[model samples]
Target: MEHQAIDELPSGKICPQKPPKNFVLLVSVLLLLTIVQLYHPSIFRSLFLSKTIDSNPQVPSTSSSSSSDHSNVQEDDLPSITSNLKCDIFTGEWVPNPEAPYYTNTTCWAIHEHQNCMKYGRPDAEFMKWKWKPDDCELPVFNPAQFLELVRGKSMAFVGDSVGRNQMQSLICLLSRVEYPIVVSSTEDQRFIRWKYTSYKFTLAAFWTPYLIKSKQVTYTEGPTKNGLFELYLDEFDEAWTTQIDEFDYIILSAGHWFFRSMVYYENQTISGCNYCLIDNVTDIGKQYAYRKAFRTAFKAINSLENFKGITYIRTFAPSHFENGMWNEGGNCLRTKPYRSNETRLEGLDLELYKIQIEEYRKGEREGRKKGLKYRLLDTTQAMLLRPDGHPSRYGHWPNENVTLYNDCVHWCLPGPIDTWSDFLLEMLKMEGMRSAEEKKLRITNDTTLN
Candidate 1:
């Protein structure tokens, strides 16, 4: 064909040319893609979207959907992890809780009249509202329902002095919010009291073993008759508790104040020495030595029980806030708030006794492990030391100017700082239960695989 040259169009004239088939198809495909992207953007995003690193080098780069899902998972898991983590519950500050004083002194029947600081007219109500907050993690509030479930079909005994009784009573009062336990057994002296939560088949008992060892009142009728002496049998277990030790699933033992009294020590039915007794030809051992020996003997006795499968807890010495004077010298805890860590100062004896108890607990734990028994130390010393205002002091007794009652700085007021002990105890129980459940699951999985 002969080639012909085409004429150029003018500036205002439009020139039209036939489009190629592939070009038309390409245009149609592009238009369809645009429409699809406008309607459903996710498919386009998957192909084109990219994650950018955060400006701060510390923050890691993450995909949008994946990061969102991860954040949700962490939010859900934070509480579970916090509750299960093994934290130092002893090291904490007292925070105010509006729904505190779990049970009022007037409402709780277990509270003794002497320990009812509120009923006796404590002017400051602020002390009852505070709660213990551990330094590392939040302490779970005392859950009565969970507590009952954990202790169901189990019996727990608090063995030691009145302070031990105080803790037991505090636990009873805390649990009473869920259900009122009936008095299963109580003597006229109330030395041995048992309460039963019938629905749960749980029993809580208090055994009054002031010394945690056999003690006898020795009468001295010779020459210059000194008042009777308290002869403590350091090597022997107090029959009051030993006879019933195997019956309990958990046992909490505490003793300190009773050791401060004038007492003589006996081992193997022989006189060892006397504490603060100035009898001629009798050795006058110091209080620290006697206390150490008594705790050693108590742990030894508990370790000797072959049939006891219960968990044992040695509650550390609860420091008394008898300030400016002795208990008999009109000393009292007059502060209305908890002391800061820097402000608190424990007595030499209090610290020494606490160390001694902790050492004995360690020893007991080592021995207990060998026998398949578990032992725990309830370190409540530092926590209680900060709460000088938690005591009943002059408020524990009825207001009477004529009656000269000693200020009770030794025992804590009901619904006071002592309630934190129960909180700590519940957390420990939960942790222990978690471990046990994990171990059981592991065993089941192993068995199933073998089958």
Candidate 2:
């Protein structure tokens, strides 16, 4: 009947026909479904966006990954919102996530003794239930198998202080469900370590260059409190990481808390300045100057590394949440939950150090373009700054039995908020994959560029 309604012109050509009512209704339903897919795909199922992504989404060939990591999700999993919303994942607030904490202390053996808060009897478990939610979109849980596919045949090195190693450890624990890597290289002190995933040929390593430059720790004593001072050489690159990073495909640089320690600056083998080196006639130039110079040297070195052509990510400074007193004088982070967006702000040394890192990253990016190298930033500063409750605090030991530091407000607790940093990393990897070659070449930042 609908076809019989066609109109004919003078030349007997069928000019037009009205659309069927059912066809129009079907088109309207499809449009509504598309909107739902764009805004709220999870209404259908968990990890609902299982459609094949045009970007990198490769699963292992063997397919024996733990069922928990692959729970109702498909092998082609990607963060549903980050790739679609064009939003900044770093500028977000912590929200309740009942499905959080993919792995815990017993499940993952990579957690360090200090960060093993649960192992040492931490009181509250609520801190592990929160997840970062970007202002514009939702951030799904981290998929270990999906991340393994993203770097199946490549090498990733975490080059910085223990914080960088903390991130690497979190990553390993996240991937523990799929494969547990073997330590191919490790030092007696575990300062420098390497792990290999034989199935994927994926290599992970950590270099203990806190300064990212040539430096040494000097034993210094002052009254009852014993102190350690670092002699920083701003001009010379530390061959520990610089020489070995040539073979890596990815480099994650993180170090800012170490700069707060007593430091003596060197320029050409002689003392140039000091932050707290109480020796006579040595000018105390403060840590900011030394910190900037070291970062500049590190950035400049990345541009000059002979055969090192890989992506470098400078994770911004993660702040401390010491309340009422200094760390040495009974400081602690005792909150049971995360802070609201307005409850805290990024200020003081954290903000200053973050600015310096980003400033240097921009300069390094400009220089790297000439050499055809890629540089990116995993800006975790603002996000981590809110997670005061996610630290080990007094739980680092058995109630002050015999620990070096009684209060620890610097590093984060394992199986806690720091796991969200893995979420951020996976999102950034997906963002990189979604872009064309020219888009990746452009300089990206925490806020503006991503939006």
Candidate 3:
């Protein structure tokens, strides 16, 4: 290679030479600045584009930015389903039935720990621990004052079996506070359990009919027939019930306890007019279907009134297990305190009764909506059965004894499981257009003339 001088030019070309060191340095600095701006956006934006931060404050900053996005994502990703009324095993201990030995004046031997509690139980300290009843088993005193405040000036009737009477007694006790010096009238056609209060005109009554409708109670003697099956005429009973039930404002109807009669009946009037044999509806239409039809008919009759503005509430089945069959094959509720009934152990027959009745009533509600009537069914069956503590069982059977009669029996003691039912009813009543204090005040104000 030939060597060239520091400053040399080709012929006819101006001197082409290297630039100054200062000029080279300036160009290098500019390239370095551009690279930094391109690689780090946050640094570049803060230095060059501060206007973006001022205009939109919602965007994330360097350190605190992640928290905002995390909260928004959580809200957007939440599940839609919600649980409202939770079914739970009862929280309290078992209380023995209060009226267990009403006529005996002593407790039954089964669960009663008291020697004096029952006249029949043998001498033992276990019997001494037994009072005539279970303490925790008694019905908790409900917020009756609040309830009476709600039901005051309203006409309500509890129509059912003796269980209904239990409810009526509790309700009467509650309302009696508002209306002292209570008055009761009883007769064949008209029966009234009333509390007269001058402060607010309110009447609460319970109409007793084990069968809400009428059916003949007949007795028979075995003669020409090898064995006699009782013949109950359900016609005259139903007619009488329909004629009388139309007067109530709000009807609380309950019936399952009465339906499980040991014997069934069929009407037979052929002995007089013409020789003909009549059979029970169960033999013809079937029990489940027949009951559904009858319920629908009764619903129609009740809903046919203009003044009957209140709701028709059906107190669903309250399960009782006196026979060990309902609890377990040989396991009966023999202990003192309440426990959970083994729902998994119930027999096919008992389960069938429960399933059919619930289905029938639920089906009735579906059919009722079409005809412009309202029927609200309250399912207390599972709720009551789960409480093994509430039953008298072996504890309060007789005052002094400890062994309960039948273990699977359904009738519960007063102020027991059924008292909560009244609470449930009050809640339902509020839902079905019962007026509150605020509404009543507004009404009174509106009714007054503005001068």
| Clash count list over all predictions | 0, 0, 45
User: lDDT: which is higher, 2 or 3?
Assistant: 2
- For model 2 the TM-score comes to 0.79
RMSD of 3: 24.2
What TM-score, computed on C-alpha atoms, does each candidate reach? 0.76, 0.79, 0.53
* Candidate 3 local distance difference test against the native: 0.43
Clashing pairs in 2: none
Worst 10 residues of 1 by lDDT: 65-74
Q: Write the per-residue lDDT of candidate 1 for residues 1-451, one digit (tens) a residue.
A: 2323233556787766847879878877897788757754433432332221233242222222110000001121011212424545687788777777667877789897778887888888998988887786667666565567668899999999989999998988887766789888857558898989998899999999888888877776532325656888888888888888898999998999877767777888887888777767778887788788778888888888878889887788998888899876878789999988778677688988988887777777667666767676677887899999889988877767444446888899998888888877766665554444444465577679999
Query: Using lDDT as the measure, what is the rank order of every candidate, best first?
Result: 2, 1, 3
| Model 2: per-residue Cα lDDT over 1-451, one tens digit each | 1223224345766666767989878877887677766644333322332321222244222221111111111111121224444566677799987766778899899999999999999978999999888886666667676567668899999999988888999999988877899999957558888899988889999999989999987776642223577789999999888888999999999888888878889999888998877867788888889889998999888889889988888888899888889887887888888888898888877778888888888788778867877777788888888888999999988875877667888888899888888877776665554332324334343236679
Candidate 3 lDDT by residue in tens digits, 172-281: 54334334424544543433344344444556666666655454444434222223232333322454445554555567777655454432433342221101113322
If both were scored by TM-score, which would come out higher, candidate 1 or candidate 2? 2
Stretches of model 2 off by over 4 angstroms after superposition: 1-86, 186-189, 220-227, 440-451
